[model samples]
Target: MRGTLGIATVVLSSLMVGCGSNAELKTFTITGERIIVKMETQDRSSGVAENSSEDQLVANINAADEQEISVVITRNEGSTEEVTIASGTFTDDKIVLEGSVKQWPTPIDIYVSRGNEEPMKLHTALLDSETNPNFVLLDFESSDSEDRLILSGVSRMLGDDSDKFTISGDLSSIHDQNLSLAVAEVRITSENPKSISGLSVTELLLDDSKFLIEGIAGEPFLVAIGVSTFDYAYWGHVIVIVEPGAQIEISPSATSSSFVPGSFASPLLAKSQIDESLHRKVIESWQNSKKYLAKMDEYARAIEKAAQPITLNSDVLAVWDPYYVFKELQAIEFASLTSIAQSLEDPMASLLAMEIGALNWMEYSRKLENWYTLASVFEEDIVSRRVIPQQEALEKQLDVVTNAKTIVKGHSAPDFTLANLAGDEIALYDVLANNELVLLNFWASWCVPCIDKLPKLRELHSEYRNEGFEIVFVSIDDAYEDWKKGSEKHEVPGVNVGDLHGFLAETPVAYGVQSIPTEFLLNPSGTILDRDVTPEELESLLVDRFGDIPGSE
Candidate 1:
């Protein structure tokens, strides 16, 4: 049973909501003249009557940390007296307070502060001894230094049926972020779990002071919200669970003035403490993986030297090995999610894990199949809508890779026309007709490996130009300016042409140039003689064909 301590040195009566008359009651008292609240529960019942020999006030708080917090009772706007009612630490992430006052239906403010930060007001509520017997107050502050849209406030379960819940809150954005709010019925689809067209979509107007959402209880549903600043929009969602007759509140403090968006940053997203904690864990893991990758070479060398011949861990080796690190890191980073998808009781949490894991599915094909299977039971449309359709297109590209391999060594080279820097149309056959052997190089300005081979390509062109050996650079840079800048920056030799459509450029796609620094050696008749020929291999082939021609350097 819930009870309250009155302000004066007198006994007071307390009332409980949705409870029988047989419910137990406990008496509370303030030390000396100050009010001291002791709570046995996190939920607080509203007080409806004043302390006119009959009423009391009580409250309970649930927060993330066991920090020191204070409760102050104050009069309406113009009053000067502020009485410190309760001050203590949160125990087991919860704080309960019970108190009574001479006056009922009075306003009170709760202040919470951490470390050296100034005390900030966390909540304000009106209390009476007999009316308004249930209420909530919650506040949250994100430690993430990223652009975010914060929605926080109170939620109360009405009546006894547990069929419906009401959400009322203040929604604010850092960086003046623009967002939209939508509520949808979550469904299990044949291919995956998804939400159909939203049941309702509302533009989140900054001018609007507060918002409310009334949703069905018991069944799982979705609250979709996203903020867009530029061409890209970041989305965060949560599946909320409210127990019957429970009043919960969570809101962010108004102190995020310098927050800025990073390349990978999104707003602080959570519908509950669980959501917030899990999201933070995922973000930390991602950051740690990036830090490891940046020092992969250093770590690999150190570990290789430290390991003895008979004791080296293959798993550790694989994690540091340049050849295997990409796949290994992805697996290690998302391993927990795969486990969650298989066994977590909360399907909403599992769905979140699976969605994040699917972003890099191609890197871990075995995990991809498992995730897809798991998604069939709990998939979401937010990311999958973009990923699933692309799978088909990428699978087709795989077939192109196979066909491309078949055309090498003996088959005729695929012919194409593209423009050179001088604005002249250059065709493969045309270049092949002029040179005895041609190195058809497919590259992009942004490809590090392609840029690394430039000096050797220049050397080969200078040495073999007189012997009918040519290097034709087919740039797949998506823009003409990038292609021109790269070619000039590298001082490329021989003929230079650009498809200018990036990897999707007609020539590169026709030749199945999935990855770069892809090169094909073709003869005068346009028949492919080699694929992926290294500079040393090209040198030896040239020596055999030209026998160290007299003018060669």
Candidate 2:
């Protein structure tokens, strides 16, 4: 089933005067600069199809009035604190906002409220920062026939600054055209529909197999196509990146597997094809890599089974040998995906590279040079542009690897002062002074894996406490109650400290902890012996150094 091709032409227009009282006008003009927001609403209560005459559509828009609408502009610096710089009401068929905020390196949030309905918010980044004032015109129309809202917008700089760029495009779907009747509604959502902050619709228009969406140059957004049938509604998403002043066309296709059944489907999995051949190759490569992962998991499970009977120090060599097999499987998967990624194009290649990089970091985190090599791979070609978010995520992973490099075997451990459950400050050096060896374990109550390893940790601590072995369990739980509960439930021996800030805590960042259950083994001299050792490995090491479990001998 192929979606009908509908062209959505977005033409830049001059700002139009609004017909409203001056008292009703809320402006955000800063330094004689303003952003004009124009909304056009159409009444589709007559059960007329979207193919209605352009003149009729205009008449419907002009006939609409006194729609209660509100606008809010906010600055987002990718942090928790977001500043609302400007806000206004959309009375008299328009809203004009002005602000002195000159440049926005990060994207700003634009929210629109209509009547008592939930407001709609979209993000817009500054494409041409040199321009003094910018304008974004949002055109909204209600489709009473389909029970959905149609939204589109175009943004450009106000003056004759030629540095401005515009991105205009039409979206074509690969679903059945008859499914259009099943579309209950449509709206502009975030790039990830699962993160759809406001509303989820039952159906969206697919009659023409084409929908129009506009974005600022060099920004990405999501257009959700909803299909409601058999009393179930599913959303198919498409992610589009608008280039500077380019009319790049996008063809979005959805298969049975493309949708998440009852919920939202991610654009990443949505079989979008700008270049058919490249997309097919990407799909093939992705499937092949997934098969490798399945095999890896199979091997991992077998290794886990083989290692289950490791109780005696003598059994350590044989049972722990499966880790070599696990590493081999990981290597094979990494190589396979890396090869596929190298053979693919930008977005696909970048995605595969990201997967490979993650695996590499997890398996070979102690090898800093390997991380550098992976980072270099991510910096190449269009892949770099396509994987900005992924790249940003890699920073923490890279930091872990970099920190591992500095605190590798034989290096002196970094000292930290953390508060215990009793609110008393305990220094790492102070703990190391009395203990022959210290195992610093970073964990959280929320992490199931971390909690699962508590029994083994407690057993080891009980058996080795007299032999000068200390286990420092640092809780990264955000809530104090959860931390205290987990500590008491687990009966974690030795020192228990809570970092409460979780990953944002300074100690975890200093120790380069990307994930929980990270354990660091320090020797008597406070030198790092090993890091990220598994529970079994820790037990094996203790047994090897202490000769045997007290009762086992």
Estimated TM-score per prediction? Answer: 0.40, 0.35
Per-residue accuracy of model 2 over 289-402 as CA lDDT, tens digit each: 565445444543444345354465544554444455446645664565555544434544434344434245344333343334444554453335444434444465566667
Winning candidate number (lDDT): 2
User: Once superposed on the true structure, which residue ranges of model 2 sit more than 4 Å away at CA?
Assistant: 1-253, 256-399, 478-491, 502-504, 547-553
Question: Which ten residues in a row are the worst by lDDT in model 2?
Answer: 1-10
Minimum summed lDDT over a 10-residue window in model 1 is located at 2-11
Looking at model 1, residue 466 earns an lDDT score of 86
The CA lDDT of each predicted structure is 0.47, 0.48
Could you give candidate 1's per-residue lDDT for residues 124-195 as a string of tens digits?
A: 233444322121122212221111112122212222235443434444543333322211112222122232
Superposition error at 242 for model 2 (Å): 15
TM-score of 1: 0.40
